[model samples]
Target: MTTSRSFVLICTVGIFCFISYNMVRMPALSLFAESLGAGPERIGLIVSVSTLTGVLLKLPSGALSDIYGRRFLLRIGVVAFGLPPFLYPFITSLDALTALRFLHGLATAIFAPSALATVAELYRERRGAALGTYTACTQSGSLLGPFLGGYLIHAAGFSTAFVTAGVFGCVAMVLFYSLHLDVSVPQRKEQGTAAVLSEMWKGFSVVAKNTKVLITSVTDAAKMIANGALMAFLPLYGVSAGLNPGEVGLLFTVQACTSFFSKPIMGRVSDRMGRQPLILLGLSICAGTFVCIPHVSMFPVLLLLSAGFGFGEAVVSSSSSALVADSSEFKTLGAGMGMQGTIMDIGHASGPLLAGLLIASLSYPMAFGVIAGVQLLAAGVFWVTMKRM
Candidate 1:
């Protein structure tokens, strides 16, 4: 397939895949867990466990995609995305639902790095813009998913919401299967298992020793820490603060809308001006906006802050993936992205767990403040490291 066609097809796949993901993820997951008699801590576990799957699998999946091919893994990943939500309506208990979320998490664990690696390959010269555009498509899905999920839950119920999400997921899978070209087989001679292992290790070491990739991944992780916290708790907080489910969903929509609008522009700027400065700026924006979330009670004020967070998120993310791809060897792009996903998922998984503990013991301000502090420290460390290097 032509690069343009591939890019459009991939973006379309991302949109539907993420729509399915966020539909079940946001207001629905927490609220559904709540309905099942889960408390804050359990809810946090349920929310974060899906990301736990990513932390464990993303590196291996990405590495495997490098050794094998992108399309095969992508096919598997999209299947994971397409099928799981259909089972959600049948879930009977918290444990069962958590298990399903973990399963669903596998979809992203597989798809994300593979798809990213494909994009990196497809647009080696304009990676920043390409990655930005692809992510923006997913963010647009996020924008629509939560709002639709919340409205459906409020109007029709969880069963209807979940089933609808399943349908979108299936559509994404179909589009991906139909449109993505088969990965071209490499010309390398067939290798023994030991040789394969050695190649994988080489790729691993390539990414591990790259300071730029490491720093960028950690900085991205810091952003995700805040992002994950907001994603897990914001709906509950908004509801507690007297916002309805639809309104809470709109908050996510607003945040995603801002991100959708900002990422491609920021990505183009990163291509021109370099990535580190943009990454630093974006991290600062997220840290500040995140710390202020608990202080705002008005819906409009919260919306503005969420938008700020989104823009921050956009700038960092658009640059970070491109930076990782830039830092890796040509053959190890998937490994680099895998490492990035693994690190980011660690932060993402930790967010809900840490926030759950903090909120249980301290006030929301204190909880959010500590998360914000982590982002600031990461930014500071990243700046110092880059300067010294």
Candidate 2:
């Protein structure tokens, strides 16, 4: 397939796949866990277990894709995304739900790095714009999924919502299967198991040592910490604040909608104006908005805060991935992206756990304030570290 066709196909598949994934993820997952008798800490665990999967597997998957090829890994990823939601309806206990979430985590863990690497390879010159556009497509899923999932759960129920998510995932699988990706795989002279392991290790070692990649990933991780916290707790908080599930979902939708619209524009700006400044600006925006979330209980005000957070997310994300790509070796690109994913997942996984602990021990305002502080601290470190480098 032509590069343009391939990019479009990938974006299309991404939209559907994420739509499926997010429908189960956001308001639904936390609420479902609550229904199953989970408390704040348990709910945090259930939400983060999926990210834990990404933390463990993303690097290896990305490295393996660098050796084996993106298409092969992507196929597995789509299956992971498509099949797991079908099992949510059967989850009667928190343990089962946690296990399923971990399994479902495999979908993004495998697909994201490979797809990102593919996009980078496809548009070597305009990576910021390309990655931004691709991610914006995925964010579109974030935009729509919560809205749909919330509406479904409110109108029908969790079972219906999950089943519908499964359908979207299935559609993504079908679309991915039909598309012919013409990306080239690395050629290896040795075909032994040891050789493959050595190849993967080499990719890992190289990426792990790249200071720029590491810094960029960590900065991105700081943002994800806040994002993850919101995903796990926002629904509960909204309900407590007198919003319905549908309204809670709209909070996520507004956030995602702002992100979806801003990413490509911010990405192109990052391309022209440079990434570090935008990263700093975004971090500040996130911190400012995030620390204010629990201070207000009004719906209109909450929506505004959510949108601010989303725009910050778009700014940080649009630049950070491209920065990683720019910093990585061409041959180890997948590993670089994977390293970013792994670190970001670590931060993402930590968010809910940390927030749960803080909220349990203290209050929502304090919890959010503390997390927002973490973002500011990370921004400081990134700036100093980058300057010295």
Candidate 3:
């Protein structure tokens, strides 16, 4: 393989490690905080604050990658990403935890945009397959994390699980450092603030005006909301229904296994069959499956729903990313992906909190129902917009 391809694979493996590191701690943060004498409100603040920071910063990071070189910005992500997990054990107060979470969000803001920007640069000609492979790597990392955590927490406790994530991240950083790329963020000879703003505005303008991207972003955002709930709430949901930790872990496995294969298949199909139809079908399936989720409580039902959810997300995630990369220039592709991440993060940030609230007041079914409805609407939007494109 070429250097860039090898680099992409290395970065992907690091991402896998990163998710494996964080998966257990993130989903179980509320429980971990509870052990530390925090309640839902505190956990909410910690989680939301971090999420909010990441959501808002994607745009600037993308712009920076465009202007400053993907290498510099990616290094920012590596340091930010690799170092944060070490500090978790040092957090003695809720405020400290919340502050760390916010800082941690910067890792995603920097890394995802820059890393994805690398793929966009190397695979510009075949992003559907390339990003499919890329996202699948992340899903694989996410897949491994919870299972590792569930087992590890019993053996080592929460702090071990949390601190270990940082250590694993160092492994990823080392690999990321070794990989080389051909693209540098376009450099300028000392431009004015107005010039920078104009450039940023132009990126936003393309995001707003492009039909393929608008549809792709909106639809994928909706799909992420559904997934956000599943990843965020499945453990509670499993326990509430009287399932064991093993069972809960299995659900994650099912989702991951299907999604692992879903991307590569979807990518080849999109290349052969076309992007829009596949995107539309994926969203419809995803929405329908989420609607079926709340009603399921048995082992068979859980397995089916997990696979369904995985299939839906896998299809949409790869397709939408490729579409976004397709829609923009190399100069702003990272920013474009960042904008995509930002939009998706909005749905992700909202999905969990809303599900928690709904589960408290209404029913789990209601939460899933609402998410499904949003996705259905999004599917429509995708079709209409893609038709125009």
State which candidate has the highest TM-score: 2
Q: TM-scores of all models? A: 0.98, 0.99, 0.90
Error of 3 at 205 (Å): 3.3
User: Which prediction has the highest lDDT against the true structure?
Assistant: 2
- Deviation from native of the Cα of residue 88 in model 3, angstroms: 2.7
Which candidate, 1 or 2, would have the higher TM-score against the true structure? 2
What residue runs in model 3 are displaced by over 4 Å at the alpha carbon? 1-6, 24-26, 34-48, 92-95, 191-198
Q: Write the per-residue lDDT of candidate 2 for residues 36-139, one digit (tens) a residue.
A: 99999998899999999999999999999999999999999999999999998988988889889999999999999999999999999999999999999999
| lDDT tens per residue, model 3, 1-389 | 58466556645745645564455444455556556776434544555555677688987788777777777887777777677777777777877877777888787777777777777787667778877887787777667766666555656676777766767677777766776655644758769888877877877776666666656777788887777677656766776787755567677777877998889789877777777777788888888888887787897798898888889888788777887887877667877888888888777777766666666678888878988889989888777766665
Task: Give the 10-residue window scoring lowest on summed lDDT in candidate 3.
Answer: 20-29
Worst 10 residues of 1 by lDDT: 180-189
Tell me the spans in candidate 2 whose CA falls farther than 4 Å from its real position.
none
Which residue pairs show backbone clashes in model 2? none
In order, candidate lDDTs are 0.91, 0.95, 0.73
TM value for model 3: 0.90
lDDT (Cα) of model 2: 0.95
For candidate 1, what is the lDDT? Answer: 0.91
How do these models rank on TM-score, best leading?
A: 2, 1, 3
lDDT of 1 by residue, 154-226 (tens): 8999999999999999999888877756455455576788877777788889899999999999999999989
Once model 2 is optimally superposed onto the true structure by TM-score, how far is the C-alpha of residue 174 displaced, in angstroms?
0.3
